[model samples]
Target chain A: MKQSHMAFMESGNFLYTLDRFKEVPVLYKGENIKEALQEKIVSTDSSLSIFPYGPSSGGMVESVYFDILTQGERIQKVSFDAGFKNRSIKLSGLSMGDALLRIERMNGVHSAAYSSMFCHIWEKGIAMDIPDQIKYLRVAMMEAERISSHLFVASRLTGGASQNIAHMNILLLREELLRAIASAFGHRYFFGVNRLGGISRPVNINGFQKKIRQISDEYREIFHTLMDSRVFIDRLDRSAIIKGENSSGPAMRASGIKKDGRNLHRYYEGLEFKTITSDGGDALARFMVRSGEIHESASIIEQALLHSGDLKPDPEVNEGSDSFMAGGFMETPSGDASMIIKVRDGKLESTGFMSPSILNMEAFAGSVSGNTFADFLFGYESLGIWVCEMGDFQ
Target chain B: MKAWILRSFRKGIITSKFPGGRNENASPWSTPPVYRKGDQDPYCPVGAISQGKADANRCISCGLCYPNYEPSMDIHGSVSSVSVPALKKSIRIYQIDVGSCGACNLEIGALANPQYDMARLGISFTNTPRHADALLVSGVLTDNMREPLMRAYEAMAEPRVVFAVGACAISGSLLGKAVSDTLRIDVTVPGCPPDPFTIMDAVQKARGVK
Candidate 1:
């Protein structure tokens, strides 16, 4: 009979492991590694073994048993079983309202990604027909969210400089943007209005378009004011330096990669907008790029609203099929987020999410090496980690 | 430096003049809800507002009653004369808690800010029952809070004003039907958390200060 092992990782930074084995296997060259001494020096056909483990930082050690069919301990067939912490979201037997409420309780970016992931998996994959208009609208909305998040991060970074005026100004602007978002969609941070097949509520074209224009003008004036502040610029410059070659996504593009999802032509084909770039792959460059992207997003929204003429609503799905796998990639405020889904029997089989922060945490660890500890916070803030800090329940 | 200083100065005095002259630039949602006579009242989801009984202590600030109720209610609508059980020259106010989310607390705390300045109007938030004139509480009546809430009300000096800030406090909107507790609140201001101005107006009405 085969045995299993389980490890529990606690939230407050502790790891506990319980391992059980039914058979005591003969080992070669194990005298150096085995710490516990065996009693009676007897070879038994079967024995039970239990081992406890702790965090080693050298990756978890998980192993399983296999019956050896060959000589010299070389097995013909081997089965490996390993288990770690399970932290995936479960969305089952929930109404749309309840589902959205649950998502809102999640981290804000994760909530956005979850919605986008669902749309990507079910709508785009099964329907096989997503209107260019809806795609463009989504891109525009995503860019808006990105700009808002970046501005908030930049504001916090500037707060360390005692530039409370800029900080307050940015917060006010963020609040206004949130109001606009709430007006457009029902909820501010969590747009519970997005549904499968199509939008639950049609965009108030006139009001939303006008608000976008106003926000654009306001952003231009505010960005100019922020740029004028030498203190702000000084603090932002050469901070959180990431080598252009190593960085990817918006961070890289802002650091002069010139690669943009908006330019992918699936949504933004022939869309007239400026692609802003900076040679300096530093905190200020990231800030400037995000600020510039706001104007670009405003332009996209204007175009989308203008082109959205007499559009027909898409058909709704009463039920969905199974055994389908779909993945989606969206450029959020911090960086790119990808969601992979596997659906079976009209329910999600397994879902995986890769957030920019998870990847950027490594980048942050790399960048902060040999730098002063004070720079760590500024560097992290520049990456837009702080925007969702208050929103993190888990 | 000079330009920056000038810019800061030019932004200029955006402070409010409250508790003195008429409040100019009052927040659009500042006015509190008022019960009126000869009008068919809408049933408050939380039962914070009804025909004759307006319990300020039960208000949850959910903003469902003022515009939603019949008789075209405003936040600053006149308090009905017939509804009062007691007649006193000076009205006393108190805030108590049954069960509330933290939004009302923050909004009430906002009174301490430079904009509202409730202290100038002789209104202050007091933690203890002895110092409190009115118990300004927000939330639905939960089982655990019933005894404590009643005790607080009993402890009040007398002629107390209990102002409920949201629909939750008034009739227990979402929490009303399911709540097993027999506790009740008074004078509900409806809104998810009634706007700060609505709270101020409610406070004024409770004290006959307006």
Candidate 2:
């Protein structure tokens, strides 16, 4: 089974592996090759100076340290240290229920994605089948999360370009969506809202589709205005190019790759969410893809709301899985975030998380390299990489 | 520029009358919770409730104690010891992220949106600690961030107000050690990730100290 799991992992496009936690320190024959290469990458010589940006600075939303090796104006390479904010959550030896509380906070903004993915994996392991209404409702909530996340990224992108009006309006739309979500569901960010087999809180998101449509309408105009603005267009165009592979979500789609994990799910079968793509792998392309996805995500929610029934008290998740390991892939707002878990005696033995931000960070480092210092923010914002989600876990 | 000017005028005022009025859009889960009167024994995962009492500083608002404890819908914040009264009119905040789930950071950023409009209260985020009157710290204080966190505080001018913003910072809330273990916090606002209203109320109280 371990060999089969390793074989299964080898068949995929992932670089990081679950083998790291299996007591085998090194997976590949040449383990130090990558580390040695990283050492050479960070080996900045005499002529060039390395500028350290953060650990804590107002320029970033999270505490992340960046070492940008530059020569006068142009950036040569960017190295980041994501260890500053490690919460050191030990998932192993905890009950599945206890492990979940940690996962929800692993990335609070992406709690919908993280919690849903964990529940899905656990359900599959236990051979538990979720009700159709619950699945439909999950789809709606996920899409709502996607919309708000995209709105935020869009706000940051426009704000980076000094397009204050577009930025403010996008924020306004996002606030409206968040309030609507809070009313439709219980929590604003869907916190404590995903149980193992069913939804945590009894929610009625049926009529909320109207509000989703309204916010969609409002965002469309801002989207158009942003596209029409030459200044905004120029700021993003030809910046941070990642010809998206080894990635999952908008970044992958933005790189002209049409793959989305949502397309493979049966719950999203009837929803009219399309996987959008772009020509250039730059910030402009990413912005375009995400802008289009916002509408598609809104449409998915609008349609998914119809299939969802007015959920009553959650079904009792009375069953449990013992001595089992389960893991799978998920398309979070960031990209394709995947996790592998080892369970024994109904407790988590060990867990491996590969958040989309990990892949996006490599792409971001590649994208920002050789570009002028001014392009760094646009590159970072366009990729939608969150350092908070970049931590490697057990 | 002209287009934006006209658009701003057309949009009208959507800002909240917070601090003056109540926060109309506060989320229940993100607000400080209160233990109910009648629950034989409530189980709080974070020890937020003990002996039929709830402590906001330690509550992660995991909702395990729900039906036994619920949100009070108030700002539920307090200025414990001191506040920088000189910053009563205008307070420029420099946010320091020690370590968080990114939720608390976004909630703080949300204050810039049309609904909260924290700028109306003369509150804005500064990119440098030198220009800031207060340091808004969020998340659990990690070992790696201790030096930087302290350096940021040292960089700030005298009469500086420090706000420990979420449950993680207040009591560590099961994630890590509380930030208060390192720094002297003037105000502590609690939630899993305290909503913008709670944060705003805390900020207001810190400035309005007599």
Candidate 3:
């Protein structure tokens, strides 16, 4: 398949270029092709016109460059000459704390995934030998994040339901879940806890298990109450319907596709869990599947905690060989977040990450096509875009 | 539905008495500072404490003190403003930078929330530095944002105060030692991002605002 065009108007800030591929095609105004090419564009103050092309590894633009094909009279293709280069991150030969700090500085899940992809690239080949226990734990955490995120989205969506009680309930429930997660993990968002090797820290099994049980019991009761309420159901039912192909993750799963990372079981083999799927695929169905997944996650966490062992830091694992590429997918709250890594000489040569938000963006664009603008927020909320944005770390 | 409403109403006000009484029961992570001398507390990364005395001016709002600090340390107790030794009595003001990570900014914004209504006290967040007292800043001043930050600081009237709210503002947080000449942050509040109570403590110290 031809590379899909993802055009970004170049801002004259940071552009990454190495001897080869100096000039790239950019669409100018009035359907014209113009190539504004230069070498060594760095620093926000430096005025340089260059195009930064990459699978990943780029910085925010200091200034935007418009394609001036028509003698500056009209505009052409715009490209952001992304500031900073990936090489700036001197990850090699760094202490564990420093490396983790660097990883944290990357900030946001996309950057996390990008750094992970870079790690994969450094490793040169994929490590299929990852412990099943670690894999299961990772999946559980990923699902937990998804569940709360979707719940929050649903809670926020109910603001339009004209019932302040339901909206406040959702918010309160969300806050409760957030506290529970924070209790389990040090950070509310669960950052820096999931390391490249396995997990940075183990869940406080007893405390976390209790919290999870309490939350699950509370949520089950609350959700059951909401579902049984015809008034609430009517507000959510068929309100923001999207087909399976048009939606992502639980939103798509509600429309009936049992594709879950837990099923893949690539990492966590012995972990027993149930995949929540619904056929209605409406706003209500999406909410139900998400709510159900919360239970599933809590179950998985409980299991992981029960089976917990000494969590030791993995020694610096070497990237097997150069010229190797591998991709890892984690089912984020929005959908599947895939990371592709290319390695050369134990260094990240090139990396690309497709955040679930990007996929959900596609899903949202497609789902909202026929719907009126008023229904846009409802449809968007049903798919859980705000939490997706948080996951995007943008 | 009718039954649920009645049950909820019976639950009574879950709203906290934060801005009112000195409620010790804050969030688990919401700890106010307790000044002690030379206590090896691992909560704060930067040495915000000297001889166990927490200089409210030096304290960064990084939640570490509450979570990872000494085991005996009460996170909720640390959520309240630490009384700092006064240099002079002056009305202190605070500023919020929207460009930085929203964590500290959100916590600062939470002051306006019904639960922690900061306006009930004399504290308030102002947009411009002209009407302000102290400046509350967050995030590592990015290379592109240096001018605006400096400009705001310059714009503040004399006898001004500046309190850095997060780790980013203090010690450049995770931005690392690589300092950008153009975008250098002046003050530092530490933590991945500190809680609001930490911020409240800092503001109180700056302006002597009760």
Assess the local accuracy of residue B126 in candidate 1 as a C-alpha lDDT between 0 and 100.
60
Question: By TM-score, how accurate is candidate 3?
Answer: 0.61
User: After superposition, which runs of candidate 3 have C-alpha atoms over 4 Å from their true positions?
Assistant: A1-136, A160-162, A196-203, A228-240, A280-282, A309-324, A344-346, A369-374, A386-394, B9-165, B168-189, B199-209
lDDT against the true structure, per candidate, is 0.49, 0.79, 0.49
Put down candidate 2 lDDT per residue, A18-98, tens digits, no spaces: 222221213221233335346664465445566767768776778876777666677777766677786788889887777
Of 1 and 3, the candidate ranking higher by TM-score: 3
Q: Across all candidates, what is each one's fraction of true contacts kept?
A: 0.00, 0.70, 0.02
lDDT of 1 by residue, B13-116 (tens): 44346535554432222233465444666444336576755444344322334334222224453232222334223333445434443334434545544456
TM-score of chain B of 1: 0.61
Chain A TM-scores of all predicted models: 0.69, 0.86, 0.65
Q: Share of real contacts kept by model 3? A: 0.02
Please provide, for model 3 over A1-394, each residue's C-alpha lDDT reduced to its tens digit, 9 standing for 90 to 100. 1021111112222122211113323322112122223212223324333222221111111111122221122212222222211113344444333344444434332223333333333332554356655555555555555556655666646665655666566556555555565556545555445555555544543365676677677767777777777776776776556676665678789888887765663544677888889988777788888888888877876776666533544543443444556766656566665656555554555545555554554565445333433444465567754221222221
Per-residue CA lDDT of model 3 for B1-210, tens digit only, reads: 785687577656665555345533323322335643334654344466555554433343333343233222233222213333342343445454423433454455545443444565666655456766666665555433333345556676765656666555555544422222223333334444455554555555444444
TM-score of chain A of 3: 0.65
Best by lDDT: 2
- Separate DockQ for every predicted complex: 0.03, 0.42, 0.12
Isolated chain B TM-score per model: 0.61, 0.92, 0.59
TM-score of each: 0.54, 0.90, 0.61
Pick by TM-score: which candidate is best? Answer: 2
DockQ agreement of candidate 3 with the native complex:
0.12
Ranking by DockQ: 2, 3, 1
